[model samples]
Target: MSSTATKTKPSTNPKKKKKQQQKSAAKKSSAGDATGDSKQKRLATDPPLECSKSDFDSLLVDASGLADYGEASSELIDCARYGEVDAVRAILDVWSPGKSKDGDLPLESGQPARIVDAADASGSTPLHKACANKHSSTARLLLSRGADAHALNDSGNTPLHWAASAGGSDCVGLLLDHADALHSLGRGGRLDVLLKNGFGRSALTEAFASGDTATVQHVLNHDSAEEDRLIGGLDRKDASEGEADEVAEGKSEGAGEKSDDEKGIVHEFDFLRCSEEGEAVDSNERPTVLIRELVSGMKSMRGNDCQGSSASRLYIHLSFSRNPQPIKHADDPFGQAPEDDTTGLGIWCASLVMARWLASPSMVERMAGRRVRELGAGCAIPSLAAAVHGSPAEVIATDLNPETVENIRHNVELNSSTSRAAKLSAATIDWGDESTYPPDPVDYVLCSDCIYQRDIVPLLRKVVSGVLAPGGTFLYVAPDGGRDGLPAFISSMGKNGFERAGGREAPEGYRSNPLRSGDGEDCFLHFHELASTRYVLYEFRKC
Candidate 1:
């Protein structure tokens, strides 16, 4: 469709019309990042009976304060159901737009900005809530009517946050281009906003922790200039230890951070470095921290081989020791132990144990100690374990999370020298980077519980297809829960030539770890064979 065709009709209200045109262009610009043709086809052709109008009504009523009805206006629902642009336009005009009881205010009202201006229960404005429903036309209308892009809801969430979280990248890119909306703001301010959450969390930290590369990249890119400035200043800092104190204190207050460059980060793990005393060295760096990285990055914790250190190794050993008793539904083979009770041991150990179990047996029997790779290998405990035990000539563990990548290096070093752990290697690898994939086809690829985001399935499939050798085995473990779990994964895989190999039951010992949680209370890992079920066999392998 022509870009102009997607635009709303020029409003009689000139001010409103300008907003509409700007937003329309933004949406078009970001459309390229939307779910693409496959997602559109799925949304359009799937069972209409199952189609949801919540996103549409949420738009009409502004998506807040409508919990009482267990639903929103049916008129908007019908418009979405009918898929007629004119019908949708008509319904939006009649339906009350937003939480305002009097309906949309007249442009002449000149009303005071009240809590009502930001009266969203969630981080949705009428525009955001509409796009959430995938009602593109209604969204266009609301933007034309002058909905505020900067307004945040109870959760400090903007409409763009909702859209991006929903994988409505087009909507996100749209609002971003025209409005220059703030992405990382907390309820009260912009600095360290991404980390605060409803509880306190950096949204960037959450995205990284959840393995949402798209979300992370979006936030990081939103302020690349700032990132470069911080890096440049860091490069200029005195290398001597004596200057570390001054730089550290200055960094904590964000004194001299350089701007981020537009060339973009080659890997997600790249981050601003801190001074030796654990203080920020750059002005742009936020003081609030994400512990996952901190714990993983401490030098003392890293082993000699630059893989996970003895602390990490011991952490793994303790976590998987089956000690301190398991928790509720503990009898299940893959159930997790009480998190509080665990010494943070089970998950740490399970990652290593599982990695070795997946790769070693097959490596011995299959390709006689050839090259191997693990994608998104956090902490790389598994790859490191495989390096120690498996026959592969070389092993590389990669993750977009920089903290994890650093830990992988630390752990690899630890195991290489003092202990007979794996002679493992570490690198940062995003899903489909060809340079990261070895020139020679790999003998094995191992990943555990990596599928979290629903929209990234295509990218995951691309990575797998691109890296696998003609007969290279790809072993994956996914906890079978979430609104968008097995169904989306299985369907996408079938479309892409992956077949499920009827697998062995994941052991109970695997569940006592925290990091092992699958989709829900009863998630388990399945071994899907690349070729035949019988041909693949390692504890979690296909055969």
Candidate 2:
């Protein structure tokens, strides 16, 4: 009996204990399932990360059995592209200017909400698309709503660039006006007329390439107007101060003599006139004449008795007179003779470099049977070399100045027999007048030492675009004349669909020989230092 009492406390209830443990485990598992189901339900109710307008319209159609909006109900981009003003406004109203957790805004907000400057996959913003499609009202709206005018697309093109490429004169005008305002506020630098795209082209260049005469003229006019305003303002200010000083000083004994000297003083110094055959000439003493010999590659032609070999060279003679003569035509400022009649100052190193480059064997082969044209043919040396040595099918040397045109004609006639293989001619061509351009496209264009004036760059680009053929070549030579406009010129060329093929420094032997000093006894070679006004040759091909 005592042993049974001690064992009663250890009575086994294995089935009941196992059943209770099973119930507890089942409750825990049920709670986890409920929590997981709740999470799934919440996830199902959430909106999609990116919802286009089309998707929303589809959802509404499915819910209400309504007709679909089709292509019209796509997104903000579609609205802009299709010129849906009301739709764009509605979408922009609720759109917050920021990114969401999913990087892009959620589509549930009625049109995949986009910020004003938000770009699509192609990196084109609403402004870019609007201007590109020539939707002036849409572009105005976006610009008014603070869209970035300078925002770059995938091709590094601004909204203005697109406008220029599309030949939208109104859009170009609006963007340029906006740029002026930004520049005045010191927000942008000089309105960046020289700003380049991915293709290294400027807005001005694009306008010219598109063959939109109105747009091109508009751009040129804008630049010229800006320059005039700046120059006029400065001139006015200087005149005012000068008048005040003169009034204060009253009538002086030397006033008449002073007026004569002031009138004689040359305000603008032409660098090209300073160096004439290495001879030291006083600035006041006008040059009477200039002579230069441009030498390049070796030339040899078999003869009966002996082998004829001589350095390829062209002799250029230019005459000048010391008098300020009125231009023949008032409308043609470029056609006017220089004030002092010193039109042909010195042979630009660029001309010599271009002559040598075109005379190269490879370049000559390419020039075969090609019509060539040269702009600003100062001495016509390059054009002469191309015709005489390069063996082009035809060559036309053109100049804006009448004197230069006559000089080029003389040189062409002088070398006519030598350049018998190619048809050569000289003409007075004004770049400002489009009517003077040739009717047919030219196979090649040559420009050397012509981009000296900043205001003339746009006109030059226009002329090049008009005259050059689709697959033609443009050979440009520039001297480092302390002007920072070369970069802008090159950028403009690129915008006009001209791609840079190659560039090089002026070769040593190809440069113009230095003029003989006093008595023609002490001869010194006129060499341009690499650090100074060195010549640069550039080759570009039109695409």
Candidate 3:
């Protein structure tokens, strides 16, 4: 009986020891869960790690437990910001197939590569960081991995905007090429070349503002061609629809066909021969005589106070052949006929508007005691007009071409009688050579259609900066001939200590004037020739 009682006691003791061990194991499990919850809370509320190499290194050490997608995503963005390609690859590989909760990428599903587009604290994706830093290879890699090129940050700037602002021309090219491919796939509106940022400026505008000529030109060239394609497509569709309607109504299609024939004839006719009466002649057979006379007036800015007291008209004559003759002198840039050599033939609409603006009494008052200089003074019309109608102390018309300079001299002589208040002079001045201009800073500098070439932009800016006096005015007229480098030219102006003072559109009549025979026939014709050309008058002041 005693042996049996001892055996039962031993069995009870073993059972009690087993129960104690089980309770201890449960306590340890609870402590482990509490620790995990605290770690998660700390991670959730913590500020984003600094985007630096060191911070990224530490993050990689603990990447194994990257199940918390928020923490992992933060680390990934930092890695991208620092251009850590290896670190980016590591993070991506870990989150690749089975490791994540649903056997998919933590941030984006299906496509693991799309994780590159995940936004950080500022709503900037890894692609944005890569672009802003000019990380072209990384950008290319991300793009190849399916990063969204059109993702906008908190500032409403896409990766393209950042690339343009950074002057990352290669990155810009990549993004633009990708966007073009997308457009070809019928995703037309996904990326906008004209997309404005928080500052109400497009990527092109930002590129221009930043003085990035390469990027600006790239965007302009691409956008212009794209716009042309869209417009052409629409025109063709409309023509087809019109033809269908004509067939359905049983109307004479002969009229439409005749109109098209006439249009073709008009296009083939030399610009000099197309008369206001719509007369068409064989341009190759004979040189069509083209003559334009512009009569422009300037009024007082005093409004009702001065009435028409200050209003005055200035006349300018322009003549050229519809088919320009070959230049006899090899050095002559503008191959004008020897007989009409004094007539500055390629008169831009910007020159007309600038002349008009200078003629305004208020504008004249501002130049009352100032020395004014006009660069690339084509035909010298603006200078002559300013001399004849405005009250500048002196006016110097300068051109790079010797023939153009001689023509300007002749024009000054022609208008000398009327230019009583101001002294007008013409000189052959090369903007690239600073010695040609006066040593003393000029009070006003006028520029029109001078920045057509990208290589000359820097030279032009240098000349303007060298010649302009402190607090002086620089009046510029840029005609929109799809000049890709214009924005960069303007941006360079700001960097050279110039600020926009004011701006205004050309006179309504001048803007709408058609070159047809009418009141102010030559002026109307000149305006009409440049009607599709947009002219912007910018008034900038040196600080």
Candidate 4:
């Protein structure tokens, strides 16, 4: 469609549009780290998604929000935002006039990629608008017509980032499917989940910010899903070689025999195992088995090694163990436990993600000059993270078990950095006994990947409530799904003088990619370990 073909210019309210365009100073100041200042400024001023009225009922669409794009394209943007199927079809037909006759890309118009992905002043493509609004059908149509999935808006977010923030699997799944398909078409199939926004938030970060576990899981399962499809295709042709042959093969392999690719993850069982006393259990009841990299990060925990690379042996060190121990609060109930040791001895995905968050510039700001406490310290990754990068006044890594405490202390000693020596300490803080609560004030509490068992919810709340000083924030994380504990914990805490923490005191927004802000190897490993599960982070403060 020609820019002058229509007369409608965007009538977005100026003030509202400006509010939407404002970027945090950290983002504006950090452009030098990614791209040139002038270019980043121009793009930064063009953030995607502005609520604007469409020709239809007050439907809001994320148009270029810049009226300079002209009338015809503006209407197309509105159609995409409104998810008007027929309207989009009609507009595309007009733009690519020759394609209506043959039903192919508008070859005569140069290419449909240019038309469909045409950005407005805000740098948002039609696909960006569609995905942001969760219009999957519209997004699919644009993809079919050659929309560029990697096209960035002013904020540097691609359609995949917006889809992830939409907080559901459909849009994310659609984008992933097209990413693979688009690559086959030489149109760039792989969507860059690593591409950061103005605030250094990636698609995965958006999923985290959206507070939706399902979306997180879908993105994490992205590569594995592809592997499954490939394996299925390979096995299909061979399976049809007569019933006799298939039966023989099935008998040999046995029914429901999963591929060894099971990684180190064995089976789903109670995370609430016998570890209170850290004593050995009966061999038959709790068999002592140790699978390297248990199923937790089996495929992804090692980062790329999850795909097929050899073991990187990237283990995190904690207190007194000279040997590295894993981190987790409750039993590694969700999955991915080291077979021989209690879950407290194995690191958990949520803990890694929490460590990543603690390492971020914004999170560091929140922790600086404050006293932080880590409950169910596990391997004390968060405590290590705070001491090493947060510049906190103090960081106490605590657990119910004396053994875990010694391990935590040993890990702290192993670190031996000036900051670690000055700020980090480990102690035994029994969750079941309130008398063990320390007298020192705590400004923040870090708890992750331990909220699996139902019985522990009430006491966990009590521990946090007892330890945290007034106005102190509680940073909690756990799987968003697959357990009954989360909602119950939230509800119990909410009724007992707790409220969702939000304000100037808490992090207003991300200033950098939390997963990428720390030591490259540790941060990258944490990022991948995080992607292996559907964990979600929550921040709360005393009411």
Candidate 5:
């Protein structure tokens, strides 16, 4: 067999050769590169080892730009679509976080997003392809490298939609854990709520359409049995403590059912709509920091930290704003501004009151090594006080509003001590969504002036039940105004498996009369009026 007999490839006809040359010239002119060079192709080639830095860097730039320029396929995207984990990992290993690309995700990170999240002409990403094909490993790799789970394709289907549609329960589980991540807030502004597709079908609907029972159940109950091993959280700790069997058995038997102990003993306790548990403040344990002083020091660093008792130097950011409209009642010192936000940019007396309590030597000493969380912590003064003064194991300051959470983080950044800063964290948490609760049940849930409306009591109670550990304490602060908020909380909590442990007026020493009188009321303008107004603290323990 001669070479000519075996391989007769060349076209000898003049017209055909001329036409082929013309087509080739046109392709070269259009493509602008005729060598058929590939970048990040090392990940897809034989051997499949990570490429050298020089090759990877050049390839990273080229592969990163392919989707942006409207090409349907790139080295990374094709590798992921083929379920090439090693290839995807090799590409990602060489990718740098500092290196950003134009992904065009709905809520991208400022200017452009991560290359792992970049989309092609069909709005499909490497992640979407991996999920759509049920390639869990490749999808996980892409997610670990910052893939946006909620990114939509041309048809408005998120990675979750494709994962559920493919009946990829494993992939669906991973996406659910991060569904609302990367700011996937639709009309409701919920981090745990995944948006529906353009057709109004959500991931859950897609799961049902797939007719996969496990997928449907997993979608319905966000916390599946494999949640700990998969998404991970406080519940995982039970396994290490040899309590996995009991816990798993209990969840399996009666996950949504409340046992007798959980059934509140409302029959035994005498409760009233506007009644409180107790009204006694120990004179010996009273706070020395004047409530008036807190009003002045709130906007800055001076007296916020237990009246500077903590050795750690701390600072805070608070912008004074006028009351959207001045209310006749001086009870709400830090009332809503723009007539919408009950707590605005300014610090509230409730937060200061709680901060004063948290900074107390008794509370501070008891809080050490405890996990504490504060809801609606404007400026996060109480949470910061716990972190700085008490040195709690961790203090999470949470709010439903992202702007408020950002402000909380801003305050966390101003504190000078790295250790204290490390102990304090800020996150957006919704009271209504159980999925948004911290992975683990918290030891203590603190609230400051959050219960002012009858509507949110149920949500607050729901969150408290979801986040609180057995016998964990919930300390709620609300002013004793004629508003139905506090009364509603008192009425509902008594029937929700909670025991009202104690109640007390914001200690007499911590109260001052409103009239600024042009004295030491320089901290926040309207709040000076709230500093002296009365606040009641209620302690409820989960049974």
Candidate 6:
């Protein structure tokens, strides 16, 4: 038989070629599968690969009923190891920790499981895992489901203690809140507690040691009763041996000549040292040197603008300057004060704002090279100083208070290099309103003493969020009045997808000198986030 020769035709589509390749590949897999030459044949592949769920069940059990307890319960270990919340919950519901089906043995072991303070072998429970990974929502779920917030791990650290030392104040706040509700009043009306860390310390101690004042204050300010309890035993001493000895000796030499006021101030300093935790510790631990330097500098600046062109002055001031002018509309938040009068240093908001910023230098450095606009730039001292020293050209100085505007001009002259002073100007700005010549979306919005009223924060937030670039920041420094302000701010930010970064302790060298006290107490007033009293350099960036 003769075959007729025919021309072969090639498929034009690329899909044809791919199909051929896949067919050949399929043949190879089939061959391997038949000879068991795949993963099973490759012993050198270490442990054999796990079977798929369907296959594993086929070999492991009869699906109609359940697997034996020993084998079935072991699945919980894998669930926990993989952090599978659903699987763990399922296992927990089926194998609930207490008594077994026979009413004799516990679900975990033959004996009954401890109820209130149970922990896993690794010294952790579901709560620890959630907190350790900063899974806040998961932690809340666990807490609501009856996970003990006070249960200690092998290290003896309750969730609160771990949260504090770990430096996430949100966690600390959560745990402290839980502790508050559960605490029982003792026979003598004292608050009973739980949740001690390995060091035998409460969450407050950890918060204080970490220098997270917001956390400390939140934990402390939960109640007047809790506040007294947390602060009760903590000794706040100021005079270490070296400083006290010198003060004592100096007093002896000036004994008769020293004014009674001077003696009282010194004595008060001693007492303050004993009361404030920041000062109670020894020289190596206490913030004394920095405090002394600030106090000394404030003494010399007496009536002059402390934040003027001097390098040292720039280093100290942190807020926008308050100026005096027609910018002071009836709507101005800072009450009216006379313009062109430099003598009224007694209640200058600008000066107080500057003093607060001096509490943390690192925080000031972080704002460098960003578009910063001050809502109420009193004296414009801080803004001018920032423009000259750190971030320049991008600072918009504004004041709604007229006296602050005039003072701002004076301060600009006081601090600026003549060339830079010419470049800086103070203007009037009303927050929460659109500006005609709004500068490039502001990278940072700075405000000081703006939280006197609770309602003002929403306004501030609206202005900040609206004016800021996508990742812009807000640096706010307010002394105690907005008691629950930070939480509200955080909640608002969260709705906008912003979270709190760690805050820093205010610098120790800062002192409220202009607001003098005839008494010797070291006036260590603190600014707080929420209800916490901490001297902080807070930073909040846009989501």
User: Superposing all C-alpha atoms, what RMSD in Å does each candidate have to the true structure?
Assistant: 20.1, 29.8, 25.7, 19.1, 26.8, 24.6
Please report the TM-score between candidate 4 and the true structure.
0.43
Q: Which stretches of candidate 5 lie over 4 Å from their true place?
A: 1-344, 416-422, 512-519, 523-526
- Candidate 6's residue-wise lDDT over 1-543, tens digit each? 001212233221110011334423433442223212122111011122133455433423321123433433444333333334444344444444443232433454542243212344556665665455444544554555456776666677666655555554655555545444445422122122223544455554454445554544444433321322322222122334443334423343223343322221121121112212233323323122101100111211321232222321211111112121222232322234323222222133333344345223453476655666776555443464455435444666665544445445544433344213224666665565667336668777776544434566687777676677877777665433223465566457555656565455543333322221211112221111111223345567777
- Residue range 1-543, candidate 5, lDDT tens digits: 011112222221110011344434433343333222221111111223234556555545544544432232356677777676655664554443443243333233332335576666677788888887777777777776667766778777877778777767877766665443333433121212234566555565466456565555445444221212221221122121222223222332233443422211000000011112222233332211101111221232312322321111111111121122232222443335412233434456677667656666677777778888887776676676667656678889887654456546645643324234246788878676777889988889998876645676787888888888998989887677644566878877766589998888876534432111211212212233244357888888899
Say what the RMSD of model 1 is. Answer: 20.1
Order of models, best lDDT first: 3, 4, 5, 2, 6, 1
Clashes of 3: 2
lDDT of 2 by residue, 1-543 (tens): 010111112111110011334423432342232212222111001112134566544433332221222121235465566554444444444343442323345444443344666676767777777777666666766766667788887778888777777777766766666655666666663344446677656675566455565555445434322322212222112112332234222222233323221221011111222232322334533211112212111111101101211100100100111112232432232333332222332245566567766765677898989999998776676787777666788899887655557556645644565574458998866677889999999999998867655766788888888889998889998864443466788887876588888777655434433221221101111222211246777788888
Model 6 segments beyond 4 Å from truth? 1-365, 388-391, 418-423, 480-486, 504-507, 511-534
State the lDDT at 317 in candidate 1: 24
Q: Which digits, one per residue and each the tens of the lDDT, describe model 1 over residues 302-400?
A: 112124323222222221222122222322322242111111111222243354344334444553466667876765656655555444577787665
Each candidate's lDDT (Cα)?
0.38, 0.51, 0.53, 0.52, 0.52, 0.41
Error of 5 at 54 (Å): 99
Write down the worst ten-residue block by lDDT for model 5: 265-274
- Of the candidates shown, which would achieve the greatest TM-score relative to the real structure? 4
lDDT of 3 at 533: 48
- TM-score to true structure, per model: 0.32, 0.37, 0.39, 0.43, 0.38, 0.33
TM-score for predicted model 5 compared with the true structure:
0.38
Score candidate 2 by TM-score against the native. Answer: 0.37
For each of the candidates, give the backbone clash count: 58, 4, 2, 23, 1, 36
Question: How many clashing residue pairs, candidate 5?
Answer: 1
Stretches of candidate 1 exceeding 4 Å from the true structure = 1-353, 359-368, 418-423, 512-543
